[model samples]
Every structure is written in C-alpha cells, then in structure tokens.
Target: MSYARIGKGRNLPEQLEDDLRKAIVSGELAEGQALPTEPDLAQRYGVSRSVVRDAVRLLIAKGLVEIRRGKGTFVRAARGEAFAEALLLALARNGGTALDIEEFYGLLLPGIAALSAERASSGDRDRMLLRAEAYLEAFGREALDPSSDGPGLLRALFEAFMNEILKACDNKLVELVGGLLVRMRSFRDLAPEEGAREGGVAAIIELEERAIMGLARAVAGGKASEARAFAVRLCELRPSLRARLASTPAGDMPKLSFDMLAPIVQDS
Candidate 1:
C-alpha cells in the first residue's frame, strides 16, 4: 500500500517515523500486521531505503514493531516497557528526584487504593496479603541479622506489594503509571517520616506494613473506604524517607523544584 509521499522536512527520518507512529496509534496499522518491506516503503514514501530503515529502527526502539529475519516487520502490541524507560529517562534528565516521584505517588496512592478495594479480585487480595506477610518476615529477619539479604528482600517485597495493588486497581493506564512510580522509587524509602518521627522510622515502616495487611484484608472483605483510610494513613506517615534524601548532595543533577516540597516533608 502506498503512503502519501512525505514532504521535504527538517529531518526526513523523524518525519517518516512520526507519520508511521501515528498510523500505529490510530490503528491504521495494527498489532501483528506486517509492515511493507523497506524497499517498498522507501518507494511508497519517496525516500531512500536507508531512510526507511532508520524510521523502522525508531519505531522498533519505541516498541511499536519487530523485524523478523526474512519474515518481515510486524506491528507489535507494545508492552509499555520502552515507553516507561523513555519517560523515566526524561524525568531524570529534567532532574526529577525520588522526592518528586514520592509526592506524585502520594497524591495518587489513596485514590488507587480506593479503586483497588472496589475492584480487586480474591486472588489479588490474597497475593497482596502474601506480599505484606513476606515483608514482615523480612523485616524481622533484618533485625536479627543485619548482614542478611533481608533488607534486599524488604525492598523487593515493597515493590511487589505496590505492583500487586496497582494490578488490583484493574486499570491498565493506572498500572502503567504505578509501575513507573514503583521503578522511580530509589528504594531508599523502605522507610518514611511524615508523622512517623514520634514512632521512629522503623516503627513507622512496621506500622505501615500492618496497614498494608489491613488493606489486603479490607479488600478481601470488600471495604473500599477502609482501604482508602489505610492508604491515607500510610501517605501521611512516609516523610522520613525524605530525611535521608535531604542530606544527600544533589550531585550532577540540577537541584530545583523539590525544595518546595522540602518544607512540607520537613513539617510532616
């Protein structure tokens, strides 16, 4: 099939890539469908084979298509990993910090929790409970053996527990954003301080763990309001993780924006 000839432009490869991307997004192209071969695409677009190859490469990097050896290129059902990686790269380039991600997630977690409560399946609830229980076991082991892998287990469990909750929310867009948030986590916050100073960081983390357990139970019991309450409490209690971030040098990344949240995190 002939595509409209791309007009002369600032960058031929980029323009071609954009046009192809639009076709993919708008479903002019479809998942698992073969794309025109390079020579054919080059002829159709009135571009060189090299330009077609470059455009296809860009689409591949974006996770839109895969080139099969001899079989040809096919539109892919993008899993969002490449997109997530690009977003995170942009965020880091713009000096996005752990605190920035935390605050952003803070704004969303309560709502996510409420939605999960309303929609989570029994399996989701069961998995969440398991993750919560595993974290507690890791926490106890960490206390007893400082050098054990328990700390690492704690971090993994933390991410897994959040992943489970995000999945339970049953919204693919939310799950993607939440997955980014999970990755954006420095894991430095295996602890938070907001109102947790009185209880101490470790104490606060344990309390939050119990709340997670409670949340899973609430979801199982079909209590959306209770789930949101647990999330809000966890949100209000997580500022301590920011304490460590505060003292850490900004290093090469530009230091801007996060200072505004500094006072709020400190006040918490």
Candidate 2:
C-alpha cells in the first residue's frame, strides 16, 4: 500500500484517521485482517502511542476497524457500509422526518447522477440498466397482471433502483448516504392526496419508472448535465414527493428498523 506524509490541515489524530481511512477505502487494509499494533503504527507514523491509540479509536467509531478483547484490532466491513450503519444509528437516535430526508436527497441525488455520468464504467452502467429493467418488469406485472404483491413491494423496487444508481456513481461517501436514504422506508407509508391517486398507484409507478429509466440512460450515456436535469424534472413530476417533504417536521421522522441497518460485507 502506498503511504503519504500526514498533511497539516487537520490535527494529528484526525490526520491519522484520514490516512488510515484512505488505506482502508483503497483496499490496502484487507477486511478482517488485523491492523498494525499501536506501538508499530506509532513508530511508523512518528507519533506517540497515545496518538496512535486515539487514531485507532477514531477508526473504530468510523466502522473501519473493530477491536476484540483478546485479539488485536482488525479491519471491519466496507467503509461505505460502516458509514451507512453509523448514519442510520444517528438518525434513529437524533430523530428526523422523511421529508427532511427527501430534502437531503434533493441536495444529494443530483450530484450522484452527475458523478455517475462522469465516472460510471460500462459494467456499472449495465448493472443500472439491469436494475431499471427489473423495476419495470416488477411494476408492470403488479399493475397490468394480477399479483399478490402489495404496493410496499413496488416501494422496495423503487428504493432498490435508486440504490443501484447510487452504487454506479462510484463515490463511497455519496453511496453511504444513499444507502441510508434507501433504507429510510418510512416514507413509503406516506400516502398521496386523494386527487393525486386518481390515476391510481400503477400510474404513479409507471411515471416514476419511466423517469428513472430515462435518468439511468442519461447517466449511462455520460451526459452529466442531462442526468442532473432528469433528476430535477422527476421531482417536478412528483409534486407529492416534495409535498411530503414539506409536510414532514424534521424532528418527527419515523425511526427506521434496526434490522434494516445491518452492515453489508463489501468485497474489495
């Protein structure tokens, strides 16, 4: 693994944590492998053992490393999954509304689309198309054909599709936040106004699916600006989404299921 001299912007511990995190994120530190001993790290980094300990503690909190009582500290799961789990716990304890979360997406998703446009590999784009196709098929079957699947399943499909787009974006930090949003399933229960339901739930699903597919294509084609625009226009089509955001009190957001926040093991 390549190493760089610690930068001056942050304090020693923060700098230490950032360097360590980069290594972990870059796959220099393999998952479940023990980290270097504190004494060894201190010597390598030219810092005191206390600073190494503090840095390791920070890594522990960030979910990049885990400590066993008898065994040494080891790399945890994927950094992004760890970050998502930590954010989920924070939301559960601090409390926030679904709309508040939507507003966050307004800020988050466009950038994700733009990034995906710029960074997505051919394989990444293919995965997105596959997910979009899956969403369309599922929704079409439920709407056009008789099925036992509930609206909740369609909601899951929507979240899964969005999650795929996020993964395609290839920004780990953004992916972490996107994972939290996908699992924030409470808003799935937020119903539209009576008039909005006139076209029926199938209509909503169809419209959303079309827009999502278009957005995916835009990203796949490497049209960064177009991808961003498609995302904004999608929200315009679903005023209720923005309405739900407006109506939700930030602190009153529902607590998501802890089971949903479990860390996923990421293969480096």
Candidate 3:
C-alpha cells in the first residue's frame, strides 16, 4: 500500500508528502475537495493515522492543501495568486544575484524559443510579427531620444515569444520557468536608448525582426530544425547584446549600470 511505503522506517512522512502532492497536482484529489479522513487515509495507505496527519501537515506547508479544523484537508487551487507570490518569494530568496537569474534564462529561454518555433500556430506567427513591427517602430523613435519606450516594447516582444512557448511546451516545469523569466525581466532596467545609440537601434530592430520572422516562417512552414537553429542563434546573440549594453554610456539616465540587469537577461 502507498501509505505502508511511508511507515516502514523509510521516512514515511516525506514519501507520503510526495505522493499526496503528486496526487493533488495530477487531480487525483480535485481542487477544494476534502481529503479522506486520517484514519481512512491511514488504512488505505497501510500507515498509522499519525503518519497520514504528518503528510497533511507537509502538504499544507507547501501550500498544496488547506486544513480546516474538524473539517478535513482540501486541495488548493492550481496557480493561485497566493501560490504565485510564494513562488516568487522563494525564487527571490534563492536568487541572490542578477547572474543567478541570467543563468536561469540561459538554461530555459532558448529551448522555449526553439519549441515555440517548432509548434506555433498561424495566429502565434501573426502575433509575433505584429510585436516585432511595434518593436521596430519604438526603436526608430527612441534612437534619437534618450527616453525611448524601447524596454517596454522589448518586454512586449518577449511576451509574444513566451506565449508561444507556454502554449506549445505543454509542460508545467517549462511554464513555471517561463513565468520566472518574465518576472525577472520585469525587474530588468536596461538603457535601451544607449544600446540603440551605440549599436544603431535600426540595426538591432532589424535583427529582432529577422529573428521573429525566421521563427514564424520556420514554424509555419513546418521546418522544425530551422526553427530550432534560429532560436539558438537568437539566444547566442543575447550575451553579445548584454556586453554591448554594459559598455555603452548611460548618458543622462544616472550612472545606470548593466551589471544589475545582466543576471536577469542572461537567465537561461
């Protein structure tokens, strides 16, 4: 029995916790549904009632379930706002530096882009193209002015790319990573005008447009390999872009530093 596996001097509480967590996430125990009574669960799992209680406590600690006094334990809603806040807090605690965030991006974004390129639908392609066009327009206007909406535009484009991945990856782990990337990106304070001034905003915009178009065309044409390669190349350019931004002057925008932004940008 599953509960017996926990009780045989084998760290039963932890094992039960894992099992119950999986069951909740997989919908074996539906959201808001009460868990079986401690005695019932204990009997079902071949464990003591105390072990079952310990498992419930563990799940509650993880925010996977809620216990009502004299009621029972109930599954929590999936991706609840409270859960998001807790997850972000946990990430922030673990993420001590910008480099840590960058390392995370470095690991995930390219793969997400590749998968997006491989699986995006026509609507996704159109949405990405529209965002790319908007980015180009923002770049052109912000090239001359120090105060350009370049970062905001770039964020929108990032979302366009990310939405494709979230829709196609069909993996919760990937989705969670993508969400973290977005959160990190939100905290990124890049001097886009400086990068535009130094590297020619028009040229950067063209590169971004090309990347978006490349992925769109590849996915639409069912060219998965080409899509994957395009994504890899795009990811490879991010490091160079960060290097360029780091070297560029901040002009009037304080002594804005890229070091702080590097980790978030570099996160895989």
Candidate 4:
C-alpha cells in the first residue's frame, strides 16, 4: 500500500491517518484483522503513542475501524456503508450554498463518472442511458414543470453514480463524499424561469447524457483520466447554474434555512 506522501512540516496525526487509511484501503490490512497495539504502531511508524492514538481516533470517527474493549482495533466489514451514511448526514446538516456543494461535486463527480465509464457493465451503462432519456423527457413539454422533476432527475443521476463505487472504493472518506453529493441534491431549488432559460429541463437531461456517454466511453476504453476529466467539467456546471439563478429576481426564490434541514439527519 502506498502511504500518502507526507511533505516536510506536515502535521503528524494527519499524515499518520492518511498512511494508515491508504494501507487499509489497499488491502495491506485485511478486514477483521487486528491492527497493531498503540505502542507497537507508534514504534513502527516512528511517532509517539499519543500521535498513534490520535490517528486511531480519527479513523474511528470516520467509521473505518472499531477499537474493541480489551482487544485491538479491528477493520470494519461494513466501513464504507457506515461512512456513506455518516457523510450524507453531515452534508445535510452543514453543506452551505450551491457553490459549496458545487465545489465538492467538482472534486468528486468527474472521478466517479470516469470510473463508471471505465468499469460500468453493460447493464450499468443501459441504466444510466435510460435515466438520461427520462430526464430529458421530463423537461420537454411546456406544461411540464422543471421545479417538480428537477430534483428527482438529479437524484436519479446521483444514485446511478453511487452504485458505481459504493462497493469498490472501500474507503470511508470516499463513501462519505459520495453520500454527501447524493444528499446535497435535496437542497437544490430550480425556479421555473431559470429552468426555461437553460433549455427547459431538457438541457439537464442532455447534460447527463453527455456526461454518462462520455464516462461510458472513457471507462470502456480504459481511459481513467479522460473519465475523471469529463466528470470535472460536469461539476463546473452547478456553480454556473447557481450564478445564473442568483442574478434573477428575488421573488421567485424559495425560503429555506439551515435550521430547517437539521432534523433530516439528527438521528443518524
């Protein structure tokens, strides 16, 4: 397993956690395997026991491993699943503005798209294409409201993307980001006028089609970098859309607040 390259003057705990996490995700440390004791890990990593403890705590908080009482820390069998839920909850509670979410999507969506392109089965590609067509259809008629189907279409896209890596990444951090992206769509608001201007919901479908097709081709061709780049371009669209919406009249805007979103994930 390749440890995260640590630059000079990097924080100890952060570096240690990065290395340990990479090791776990790379299968250097198998699931259900006991990690070395704090003292041993500290000595092996050339850090103080305190630093090792902090790193362990960081991993625990991410739901990566469990420190059993009187036993060593054990890799979680369902770490990725647990992390996804936790991340979604966190984003629902704390994710601000369309811009903030857009930035995250910029970082994640393209990579997922690329991965889907490279690794998606025929069934997966078909599913994405079908969803893209539905999304396009949803925006077609004048009577068809963009606000009504916009969120749902976006949700579908997110779900399709989620299926690509929900099992493969096996890293809590990656899963958390995926869950956050999925949950963030709930906060999006599409005013009628804005939707019409951007090709009346059809544009979104078109965009998805392009993204999915690009991803499919990239993945099928084993072009991981190309797939990732396509996703990054798609991610840029959110901020662009947000900017356009922000410039329009205020009366069309929906009344939403962070307080209103808190309860959705309070229990989780």
- In Å, residue 168's CA in model 1 sits off its true spot by 2.3
Clashing pairs in 1: 192-238, 192-240, 193-238, 193-239, 193-240, 194-239
Residue lDDT tens for model 4, 1-268: 3433334598898888888888788888888998888887777777788988999999888777898888889988753556555654564466445445545666776666555555666665556555545533443432145445555564465455454443233445556666655555443343445334433244444444565456545655557788676655545443345664334332233333212211111110
lDDT of candidate 1 over 20-137, digit per residue (tens): 9999988889889998888989988999999999999999999999988889999999678787778777766777665566667778988988898888888988888888788667
Against the true structure, candidate 3 reaches a TM-score of 0.54
For 1-268, candidate 2 gives per-residue lDDT tens digits of: 2335554667888878888888888888989989888888877787788888998999987778999988999998774666666666676576655566666776777888888889888988888888878767766665543244655776677677787778877777677777777666344432222233333555555565667777889988899998998776654413434455455555344332211111121210
The lDDT values for all models are: 0.69, 0.67, 0.60, 0.56
Clashes of 4: 5
Query: What's the distance in Å from true for residue 25, model 2?
Result: 7.5
Per-prediction TM-score: 0.71, 0.59, 0.54, 0.45
User: How many clashes (backbone N, Cα, C below 3 Å) per candidate?
Assistant: 6, 2, 14, 5
lDDT of 3 by residue, 1-268 (tens): 2344455556987888888887887888899998878888888787788888888888877788898878877888876445556655675565434444545665676666667666667776676566556654554464445465645665565566555556665567777667655555443245543444454544544555576566656655656677666656554524554544344332112222222222222211
**Which candidate leads the pack in lDDT?**
1
lDDT of 1 at 204: 35
Q: Candidate 4, which ten residues in sequence have the lowest lDDT sum?
A: 259-268
Which one wins by lDDT: 2 or 4?
2
Where is model 1 more than 4 Å wrong at Cα?
7-11, 26-36, 66-77, 150-153, 188-208, 237-240, 247-268
